[model samples]
Target chain A: MFGAEFVPLSLPPLVIGSLAAVACALPGNFLVLRRQALIGDAISHVVLPGIVLAFLVTGSLGTWPMMIGAAAAALVAVALIEAIRRIGGIEPGAAMGVVFTTLFAAGVLLLERSDTSSVHLDVEHALMGSLESLIWLDGTGWGSLFDPEALAYLPPELPRLAITLTIVALLTAIFWRPLKISTFDPGFAQVIGLPTTLIGLGLVSTAAMAAVAAFDAVGSIIVIAMFICPPAAARLMTNRLEIQILWSVLFAVLSATTGYILAGYGPLWLGADNTVSAAGMIATVAGLILGLAALFGPCRNRAGAPLGA
Target chain B: MLLDAFTLGLGYNATLVTLGSALLGGAAGVCGTFLFLRKRALVSDAISHATLPGVALAFLVMVALGGDGRNLIGLMAGSALSAVLGLWLVQKLTRHTRLAEDAAIGAILSVFFGFGIVLLTVIQTMEAGKQAGLESFLLGATAGMLKSEALTIAIGGAMSLLAVLLLRRPMTMVAFDPEYASATGMNVSRIDMLTMMLVMAVTVVGLKIVGLILIVALLIIPPVAARFWSDNSDTVALLSGAIGAVAGYTGAALSASAPSMPTGALIVLSAALLFTFSLILSPRRGLVAAALRQLKYRDQVHMRQGLLAIALQQPIYERLTLNMLGKQGLLRADGVPTDLGRARAAKALLDEERWRALRTLPQFEAAAARYDGLTDLEQILTPDQLTEIDAHLNRPHGVPA
Candidate 1:
């Protein structure tokens, strides 16, 4: 399994998926605590329309315009949700529901209206993400790890996701105090001179950044699953935010690695030839982890926890 | 072709799709009202996405059993089962774990859908899956739909609509005031379950028409739009049904008129169009109505402040106030009050004096609270009460002394 073909086929997707999963999971800790997990879901869904609009505007499947379009869409979705909630006096959840669904439906309609068969732009591709096809074509074996020549040909998502994950991690570590304070008690944080509103906005913006970067690699399913499952399972495992962050990172890496392995080889073990969707398998594994945590984790119930009650 | 489809002259299958989608829309709208009222509208989203795995599973199972996997009822049943499981998992997480409801919803939504996507890939690899058309459930496909399937959807929609009508009273009561309903010998939780089940049924039934992803739109957009037209729950429910029906009919017709038009997206877009119109045009709560009301109030304030300035012989500096007074012939171009302006100013002064006197009386306390400077004293106070207050006014202070 560690032969020439394995490094070429499996290493890049695994690393990219793991990096993307961690990228989503880091911000997810704060979001799950703040009861804003759905914002990730909403942001991911609205990215569809953004990319579709981008494609129609530029008439190319270039990654930068699509990523920019997705980021703009996320911002638009957030602004729209806020606008609808304020103007229509609609609840936040319902407002988010209306805005994201409308945008996603519009994306679907546009995709159908425009001719996209020649490009790799189907709803399935958009949803499942061709993670398996993101192969390291130039690598020969495990020895390619030290080869700068082979490294130069690595999929762009690896570097992009690494940067995104680094930025998200740095943000988390740098603002750990304010994030925890605001997530726990906004009024107290405000009384103490913390910019609670800006802090909240920054947190959401960070999550959006993570979501947009991870979307092209693992798809929205893993983005959403990583956002909720790892942190949620981590939340159940411990009371301290620091330890919870550690646990969440651990869980995210585990889910991505195991899920990719299972998706690629689990069917073979069961005597089947075809592989399943890695995005789906990753999400399922994350859910299974969360389910296990919910069932047997030390702090699963809300006896002493004050977060997300 | 589009016009013929809209007029229900497109043929039997197209007509069936249009009418069935309308009935489903109406039912979804009415059922969704209670969900929106309860502020858990996205619960339907989780349930809708949860149906995907069951669809693939149902197809796989049917194909294994030596029958075609295109049975509408079996697919619906399978989807319904999974949606219920998803709903149950959400409820379990919310109730049993430290997870908030929204987190539970997100968890269930993504995870179940991810699992479903896996199943879809699995089915795709199978021999029978080549023509499975399972992707239709993702975004419904209406082309070459069988008669039996259309009839099943129509009958299913009508039954759910009937069920919604029968249960709207209790569901509305629970949604509006759950504690009160629970105290008044109603099972609020059971009613909530009923609401979820109805939403789930609509979701499963709608899978072939509106697709799972946008089914929540049919349930959500109509009620939200209807809310602008009325505050009364009953009116909103009925009106929501009507709006949803219209959107459904129009969307299905449009989908049939073109080759590329998707039924679900068109349906959602139609509903969103109605929502946009309602947001702008509804007489009571719409944006235009709110702006108009504000404008009327602002104009009245300007007129009152301008009139007060005239009564006191104060120079009117604000342009809007001056313009308003001039337009009413209350002030001249030289900023002098016309005779009509002066007379109205004097009456305004007298009304202010009457209000001041009334505010001092303990018996007129409730009436005094209604005072805005623009409100006519005569409108709120009866003539007898006004006379009593007027009797208490300072004895004609001579020449503004």
Candidate 2:
């Protein structure tokens, strides 16, 4: 199992997928609790234009530029939703619908018109992702962890995802108290001087960061699925917020590992020669987990429990 | 060339596709009005997104069974099955969980779409999968649509229209007030299911035309636009259908003319344009119209107050008010109220005093009904009666005047 082929070809994707899943799921718990789960979906769609525009201007697929572009796009999406709601007097969901779809359409048109072959960001990859192709072979085996020479040659996506997951973990740990109070009861939190608005913005920005970091590795569909599914499933399984977070992390890891393996080798067992999309499989597995949990979870009858209770 | 495109001289394909889109728009608009009224706009989104897996699975099964897998009916069956399942899941989640409707919709939409992507990838890896043309269902490809497909859409649209016609009264009743409808012996849930089935029909047919991503706009924007124009449900539904038709025809024509523009996006943009126009300029609920009414009311109030001041021999606030009143024949231009102006000013003063008294008195709350019935000027309290009530209310508690 620890052979050279296994370490390079298979290990990287599993690790990358798992890291991406964990990164997204951490912020997703907050989103699900706040009932703003769809904002993750909207951010994923709206970031397409930002990524494309960043590539067009910089003429490179560098990580920092793409992340910056994605962040700007996410901000624009949130701002546009607010503006549409206030000016047009439309509901928030409808405002989100109008903004994200229009932005996604604009992204598609721009991708079609521009020269994006150099960046490897085409329309298909924008929607489905190119997860199968992210392979890493710097050195051999577990020993390469300490070898600086080997680390230098590692796949860029690996370290990017690792850093993103770390930042997400650090932020969640730092703001854990405020996040819980503000998300559960903003009025009381504000009355107690908890800076509820800033906490809310911080949470949204953290979700945006995770979305952009995972954009190239697992794509938006998996980002959206992981953001909602595991947390939602975990939510069904537990009542305590801390326990829910633990369950969510566990579910995210399970889906990412199992789904990737299924996508790669499951088809062979079914007599097919080629493997399927790892990102799609991961999402499907997450959905399956969520469906099962919804049916048999601990909180099935306690569905009407108050938020954050 | 522009004229040719405008006149639809491009040929039969453009004409057929345009007509098919028009029919779809009309049906979706009618179904969407009920959905919107019931505050289920995002439910359509969830249903449409959920159809993706069904479509891909249908294609795969058809191919596995030794067929080309391009059969429209097979694909539609798969889509309808999944869409209904998605709606059921949404209903269950909302009913059984602490999740709000938006969270449930968001969860179902992403998960189903993700599964669809998985199936699509699986299909992609199979032999001859490239020829399946399954990807077009994501964003739509109107140019590739055949006349037969167009005909199928038209037939589906016609069925939805017929259903709405047959169930108009009950549908409206349920949409407006389901509790009342149920009290009146109508099966509210069954009626809701029937409406959802109609919406599912339109949504499934619309997938090939507008695609999954933008189809909800076709369903939502038209009826919302029509709402600004009419108070009657029937009129709003009719106007919604008309607007949908226009949007479909124009969007298709523009797509045919400009070859590069995506048909679905253009259609949604057209609908958005119509919605913006209605929001700003509609006569009943539009911002511009409401603002004009406010300005006119302000002018009338100013004129009335100025005329009262003059009749009571008090100070005139604005000099132009007296001039405007005289021009309107409410004043004699001699800085004194004419006979008509005097009567009008006294009535206005009396009505103002009565409202003030109504606001300050706690015991007179029951007299609100009397005040509502006294809209006629002759029925208003006399000056002496108004002064007596004012003096009585102004005294300290329990002190009789």
Candidate 3:
């Protein structure tokens, strides 16, 4: 079932998609609990300014600094929204709209102002990422780690995915108890001195990491898909957080790999060149999975629970 | 710029495009109010993103049919169809599935956008000529717009205007208090559909100017800005339209000034700025009003404190201030001054103390004594009230005093 060609294309997307999925799923779980699902969307858009500023400062796409820059921008986006809420007297969504849209617009204007040689991204192209490109990134970077003949020979994107997954996993492991207690009852958690603010900040930073990782894999437009879609689909099937995480991981890996392959064949089958990108297609499929889960997930009786109820 | 428009031949085209864009923005603003209230602001994003594939497919179909360059009609038709399909899918998912409303929104938005990306890529590689003008729907181009295109916008804009006008009563009733509307047999579901159609139409019309990613800004910002000024729905809707129109015009003109500028981002920026202004300065709900209210309350507290000092008549000096502070923090009740404990005697001593004081002369003592005798007791709590407060504070948690 898993042949040589399959090992290269199918195995890599699954491995990377699973890592990326696990990373986002943890933050996605808390985001839903916070009733700030769109925070991911806002953070994703706001992180662009940081990425651009980081590039200007460093003049290179070095991973750690870029990630730090993006995370800082995401934190600033959160702060901006809170400031707008306090100063502008708008609700979270309106504040988010104002802060994120303006920041994203500023990011675009800055990109336009900068030289093309430093980075080659238009606003639209930056919002979308091509996963097919990830499949063929430098595959011989780790040759010295093994005997000269038996090199590591892994894709560059996969290592980033792995690193991101490790960070997500470690954070989740260290903060699982606090995250759960805080998410379920923030007032009580506060009374108990649980440091909900730190947990909330940590969740936001994790989401930023997910956005940065998924941004290269799927782009900003569809990162929301990977970030929100799997957990959402899994949500339909179960109410338990553990089950939701498991199912989200399962759904993201399955959908991304399947979407990538189907998109590859879209031109072959549909007569058109299948302009449908693998990331976008994966997002669509993940949405479809969520839709199906919504329809058939066992917890139908409680589907209409009103906000704050 | 307005004078430049008068001199330059391109100015005429700019004016025409501005008018159309303004109308589109106004219509989007009015419709977006209902969408925002429905918590579907991002729906505009989904519908806008989804339109790419619709436009691609529409153009491909038109090409295969040997149609002329008037592919905008097909594209519009295709966008409308896809938007409705996307809305339907969202509704179905929410109604039938265990997924939350936000999850449904995210899911639908991503999927449709993904499909649009796929379609655009295919068009890019295989049948490039067929979709020559279709890329405009992604980011939008105002320079190429003609009178005919403006006419289409006007018609769509007018239709949205009419829908808002005709359904104003039920729409407001449904948006504010849907349960009551349904209880009153107003066909809440029908009203919802009608408003959704209006919202859908606005999304479709926006394809010409703001394009996909930023179309929601047109619908969202004007209403948000207008919200600062009005409590009544009628005023909100009207102000929203006005703001929307102004933003539309400003963004379009800005983009026209520099051909390289993206029109969608300019429109979004204008709306966001306007909304931010309203958020800070609106009449009732704006930040300035809240700050003023807080300031006025502080002044009242200070005035009351000054009056209380005169009534107490306890040497109104730094020693009295220190004594008062010590009383509030006592580890021993014995530390409270005996003269401070005697209400009637305390007032007499305060009166005598004020008369002896250098600040007030003997001639003014009569007026000051009378004023002091008038009592600050009216503002301070009675004995019974103080006992009730102490009882409440001393009461156990969860047991009423």
Error of 2 at A239 (Å): 0.8
Candidate 2 interface RMSD, angstroms, 1 decimal: 2.3
Ranking by lDDT: 1, 2, 3
Computed on C-alpha atoms, the DockQ of candidate 1 is: 0.80
- What does candidate 3's lDDT look like per residue over B1-401, in tens digits? 54453333355567667777788888888887776666556656656666766777786677678875345667889888888888887787667665556666666776787777766665666544554766677656777787777677767776777677777788888888999999999998888888888877887887887776667778777887887888788888888988988888878877777646777778888888888788778767887888898877655444334334434543334443434434544212433334333443345444344333412444343444444333343244456643433343422566667
Error of 2 at A35 (Å): 2.4
Q: Against the native chain B, what TM-score does each candidate's chain B reach?
A: 0.95, 0.82, 0.75
Arrange candidates by TM-score, highest first: which order? 1, 2, 3
Model 2, CA-based lDDT: 0.82
Answer with 1 or 3, whichever has the higher DockQ.
Answer: 1
Selected candidate, larger TM-score, 1 vs 2: 1
| Colliding pairs, model 2 | A303-B98
Cα RMSD (Å) between model 3 and the true structure? 9.4
Better of 1 and 3 by TM-score: 1
Query: In model 3, which runs have C-alpha deviations exceeding 4 angstroms?
Result: A1-14, A53-66, A86-89, A113-118, A135-156, A185-193, A265-276, A300-309, B1-12, B38-40, B68-70, B129-133, B306-401
Which digits, one per residue and each the tens of the lDDT, describe model 1 over residues A42-86?
999889999999999999989899999999999999998887787
TM-score of 2: 0.84
In model 3 chain B, where is the ten-residue run with the lowest total lDDT? B330-339
